[model samples]
Target: MNLSIRWKVTLATLFALACGFAMAGFLAERSLERQELAQSHRNLDVRTEMVAHELRPWLRAHAPRFTDPAFQVLVRELGAKALARITLIAPDGLVLADSAVASEHLPGVENHRTRPEVEQALAQGDGSDLRASQTTGERTLYHAILLTEQDGSPSIVLRLGLPIVTLEEELSQLRRHLVLAFGSAFLVAVGLSILLARSLTKPLSDMAAAARRLADGDAAARIQITSRDEAGLLGETLNRMADELRAKIEEVSEDRSQLLAMLTSMVEGVMVLDYRGRVLQVNPALERMFNVTRAEARGRKFSDVFGHPQLALLVSTVLSTRVGQEDEILLSPSSRCLHIEASVAGGEQENEACAVLVFHDITELRRLEKIRKDFVANVSHELRTPLTSIKGYVEALLDGGKDDPDTSAKFLDIILKQSDRLNLILEDLLQLSKIESGQVLLRREPLQIEMIVERTMAMMRPLAGKKGHRLVENIPSGLPLVNGDEERLGQVLSNLLDNAIKYTPEGGSITVAARHVAPGGSPAGGKSESLEISVADTGIGIPESDRPRVFERFYRVDKARSREMGGTGLGLAIVRHIVEGHGGQVWVEGNRPCGSRFVVRLPVQPSDQAAGHPSLVPTK
Candidate 1:
């Protein structure tokens, strides 16, 4: 049966007490019965002694008579006085008289020679035996004596027996008295046992409840110590344990909070998985990276969450080998590249470990690496083209083409032109590199955008006329002054017009427009005004896909056409660097119907750096 400790203890105590009392009562009863039996033996011994004394004279005087009434009568009288059965036996195994047997039955009595009491009396002078009487069929305690003469000649064998029932009757009365005393003591013990049990179990119950409270995260739970006993010591120990547990939990909780904060703030995505590959925990960063909620990600399989087989296999390998593994996985749709490091996260025991996958986004880094590779290749190709042309013309002049004056002159001019193209390419490359590397410092002066545009168009007009293109100016009068370097701003307009002049078809219109833009709300919760300048051309326009990257170094929409037209791809890159150096943004769009529009947005006031000249400073 199910039982609380209190009842169980109480019952156990009562049972032990009951068993002890019962054993004591039994032992006492046995002792008392033994003592009573010993006393009865004494009484039997004394009575037999007195009867033996009286029968000694009679035994010496008369001869033993078998089956005689006189002898039986004497035995009966002696037994009445002794309050026991009496038997007289001859030395020759004859029963002369028996008080329990009739005179006629005495003649038919069994031989006394084999009887234990008779044989013992005949041999040892006296003996005692407690057994059932063979003659009377009654339980009797027998004491026998051998009557002898002065000469030591054996005369009569006398045996006395008392019924065992007589001793039992007296013992029964003692038992009733013992029962009364034991019942009173048992009642007292039961009361005392209940009180003791309550005292002991109440503290244990309190401790158990407090333990439950502690398990439930109730740090305030405490036990009240009342005594310095074992139970009190236990309670005190428990209290101290609770305090330590609370402290450790708080410490671990703070550590967890810090860990969560770190994970949440990290740019790298982190995920934890169990041995079964089920997601255990996901931080906010991972949630954002995967575009899934933490709740939805948890308990889902790693393969299911990432849907990348190679990544899943990497995690599996780490789990199986109990080692660390790392790989780069490319995410589709957005084309983001992530470097994942997976490691076993727990003990070495089988299936006890987890896979901790830390994902670092390396998309930008990879893109930069590719750009570096492409730039090296493109520079080689761009340099190789003009070098090949110059070498061909010089080799032709040295190979007897120089003997023909006209051919030699033409070849020399071609070499010079190629050399000049190469020089132009190198100068543009140097300027682009200087602007990008923050080596060029721009002058910060409030200048008129109209003057910069007008000067750029004027300088490029002869080239535009050669191409038969019409140059149009769209600057509004009274335009706001722009804070920038005059040289850098002039370079920006010159590069745009150059690109338009080179790319525009003959007789196409090339327009340079300028306007003062209103203040747009900034992300910093502030307002700032900017100046917008756009160069629009009615030429073969840049494609929508290629516009975004057109300002990048060595980028060209029509590579063959640009190289044929002697256009170094570094021109627009230099313009972008110069414009952004002034903390401005530059972009290109479709001019619609035939060409592209390149727009530059510069703050009316100079910012941190014209990045067009990163070393620039603004003057009032």
Candidate 2:
């Protein structure tokens, strides 16, 4: 029922050939039979003429002897050899002699003149068509010929009847042979048809099998071409296609692997989604950043992963409009706020929108930005306060305070003190700015870190005594020398000790300790000891959330408290800058139970430098 093209073509060709052969065979047989019949008809006519010619003379000779037995014997003998019937008719169209029937029995046949053979003898002398004789009731082919006497007068008409029974038998035998030959040819055609179908279909079947293999993901499958025909050409084409397909698959696989590598290696968290706004893929960074697994994120809506209404709404809007959108989302429930800048990009493929969302963590950046803004505002206010006080004092002296020596002297002293304080504040601000702007050049030298802490603590001792706080030094005398600028390192230690003393309550304790940390492996040095100086105090400690930004310029955990203490809020900022400039780091941590500790780490000078700086411990 499922007739393929090849089978249909073969069958059609076979059928056309069979039809053509059958038509040609039938036509050829019919033509030969017609020719044979025509030849037989012609022979009959010739023989009939011959008999008429020979019998005419006999009839003339035997006319006088009308009952001659010799004529009858002659008629019988002629009929036996030719397989024809001969008759003799008188001139009046009456039967006078006969060979097939008795002549005396044939009577009342005078109307033979109207017959084709009789008419031919009387008129044109020849005619033909087989018909039954009216006189004898015999089916015959009649031929008539006129008889002439010696004087050229017509004597009798000789008629002949050919039964044609032997000719019919021969034609029947020819028909039987033709039928047998045609039947044999049909059987042979059927057997050859089966062979041809198999020969053609076998190659096609092989191609089909190879195609199945290819469809099953075997790009190596190929067809073997044996003959250089169309089928072979088809096989060759399939082989070439297979090779190209394999190459394409390899290229695609390589590209996919490269894409995956880049995505995974990227520091930025990436999330790709399909048109339905569901998460389709996410890189490892995103999984770690968002704290969501791929299994939990995949097939889930963007809103669910981010858990922000604004972010979810933005994604939905972009998807509905098929346009790019961006929004910042704040990740919550932590002291350190994480600001996420989510951007949607790319478009749809296959009627499904493809998009990538890049989440940038900007928490530190936002904090730093806030510090910068606050620093500018605080510096302005601090500068203005000093300037306003100096201006007011100078104006009082210029008006009335200047007339009275006592008042003028008192105002001028106040103005001078305010001016000096203003100068100090400006100088500190300038130095802090220089350190922050990376313009300060460090004069590195070998200095005893223990002496530096002692000098700073000594300077803050009077302030600590006034507040009833104990300023203690736990610095070891054998502590290593540190590589640093003496002036800047002293300023850093002074600021930390001052803040510790100021924050300590009455009877609270402040301790400055210096020790040598063991050699730690660093890229720049295989093993090196660092000078660790810590200034600790039992005071209101810094909150954990503000620890990271405590070194930022003008950033204060308690703005009112810092201002009242004459603190410009730039000390820690300047200290951090100077420490980093010395290839060191400074950090603050909570000192166990209600206190703060500031740690400054610097590379220790070589052992040879420590003995040379023995005088570094100035009178404390």
Candidate 3:
């Protein structure tokens, strides 16, 4: 019923006091009454003995007749002397005498033989009983005895009884005193219990208020210590606990600050979502990655901030099942590849738990991984081919072909040719690696494109003549000077011219053209900041779908034809690396009217790193 501790204590005390008083009063009354009765019984025993002594000799002399008046007189006389009522009962159930009754009424009196005291005395030598007297109609306590002959034959029963009026009155007086004492003690108990309840409950109430304040985040709440008792000790303990709690909170706050700083400063994009899948907080990295602000994202669903369907589903799965999830997702529009890890944040209650997502941009990493894998597979296949041919032909020569001098010489020549192809492939691979790894330092200088293209065509005219073709150079006179590494740029021009000569058919033409281009991806007729160079050949043109990957290492549209032409398959790849190392671009497209065209665009100036390295001048 929401009873206060004060009332509970007071009522408990009063109830205990009431029960104790009632029980003690009852026991005390019973004890005193029994003692008084025992004293009365002892007095009656003396009287009974005196009467027995007087009648014993007479009983031995003769069997007395109770009808005798002398015996009746004797009973009346003994009762008066003992200040009690005396009775004499004959063995034959006759009430011979009762001192309280007149002599005439003795015969009319009820049979004394059947009385409880008389029956008990005749059966056992002594007996006592307490009942209302039959003749006097007063409450009496009775003691009785039997007298017998020397031969042990019972002769008569003598009994003495006294009224218990004084004992009962004394009991009544004790009960009155007990009631008065109980009433006075009950009043005192109530008063003292009320004071005790107040004393205990006041401090307890203060402690409760302090506890509520502590729970509400008030660190200053404390109970006032009034005494050095248990209550005061409890207050001191609670105060100490409050101080410790404050210190712990400060420590937690400092730790939180450090954690927030770390999250903000980290490079990996991080976001936290609540139980309902709404954004709780996001670090600056995540905001920058997603183009979202904290104010706009907070309290909004994760799907809103992260528009990718797969990422949203991952967050939902972690929230529902509390299992960690990770996947690579392509964030569209920008097409960034992100590696995301989603996991549930810890909390004591399930509802308080949240989800944390971390994202890392792996687009460059994935591109490099794909490049490495393709390089390994293609290199293995390319190396295996020439080795197989050499092995097979050598085995043929060993298996009796060597017995013929012409066959043995032809086999040796073919073996030598294959060996040269292998050496060319290894050399190209090593050169490509050096350029890509920045070991081949560029030598930048002002050079004429027209002069460079002319020199490259002159070097390639002989190879072009083998296919019944002639090399053509298309360059304007007095062109702008290009700032680049002469040897690297010459290498780029050489590889393109070599590919053109190898692929062109008999009677087909090869052209090396140079022009100018603006940075907006359009050709400019006059001098511009960049120079565009083209190597065109009337040969089997690359398909449009295969154009994008033409410059990748060992990528070929027709592998058998390129291998047949003594091509190492690394020419275009090396061309691309060299052109890009000079901070330029290379791509292939269908030439006008007939064949494929490979274009190279280079800036008129180079990066500051080109000037930082040692320079190489063009050899005249």
Among the numbered candidates, top lDDT falls to 1
Best-to-worst ranking by TM-score: 1, 2, 3
Please, what is the TM-score per model?
A: 0.84, 0.65, 0.58
Query: Can you give the lDDT of residue 135 in candidate 3?
Result: 78
Residues 58-87 of candidate 1 have per-residue lDDT tens digits of 767776454557767887888888788888
Ten residues in a row with the worst lDDT in model 2?
611-620
lDDT of each: 0.84, 0.76, 0.83
Write the residue-wise lDDT of candidate 2 on 1-620 in tens digits: 99875677568767976897679677866787677668768888788877876766665664444446677778777887667888776656666667776545556446465677777776765566677766567656777777667766556777778875665676677677766877787778767776787778778989999999999998878898888789999999989989998999999999999999998898778887787788888889878776889899988877777786766787677667766676666665643343344444555654343776777667777877877677678778878876888899888877777889998888878778767767767888888766666677777578777777767777888888898998778877777677678888998888898889777788999888877778773323427788788899999999999999898777889988976777777788788888878777789999998799999888877767654532322110
TM-score, candidate number 1? 0.84
For all candidates, the clash counts are: 8, 0, 0
Please report how far candidate 2 places residue 305 from its true position, in Å: 5.0
Q: Look at candidate 1 and give me any clashing residue pairs.
A: 578-612, 580-612, 581-609, 581-610, 581-611, 581-612, 582-610, 582-611
Give the residue spans of candidate 1 off by over 4 A: 65-73, 89-116, 122-125, 131-139, 147-156, 163-170, 282-297, 304-306, 312-323, 346-351, 394-415, 441-447, 478-483, 516-530, 604-620
- 1 or 2, greater by lDDT: 1
Q: Point out where model 3 deviates above 4 Å.
A: 1-19, 43-84, 99-108, 123-125, 132-139, 145-156, 186-423, 442-490, 506-538, 578-620
Report the Cα lDDT for candidate 2. Answer: 0.76
Off by over 4 Å in 2: 1-24, 33-251, 300-307, 334-352, 394-401, 404-430, 433-448, 458-470, 477-487, 504-509, 516-531, 538-549, 580-595, 601-620
Score residue 181 of candidate 3 by CA lDDT.
95
Q: Rank the candidates by lDDT, best first.
A: 1, 3, 2
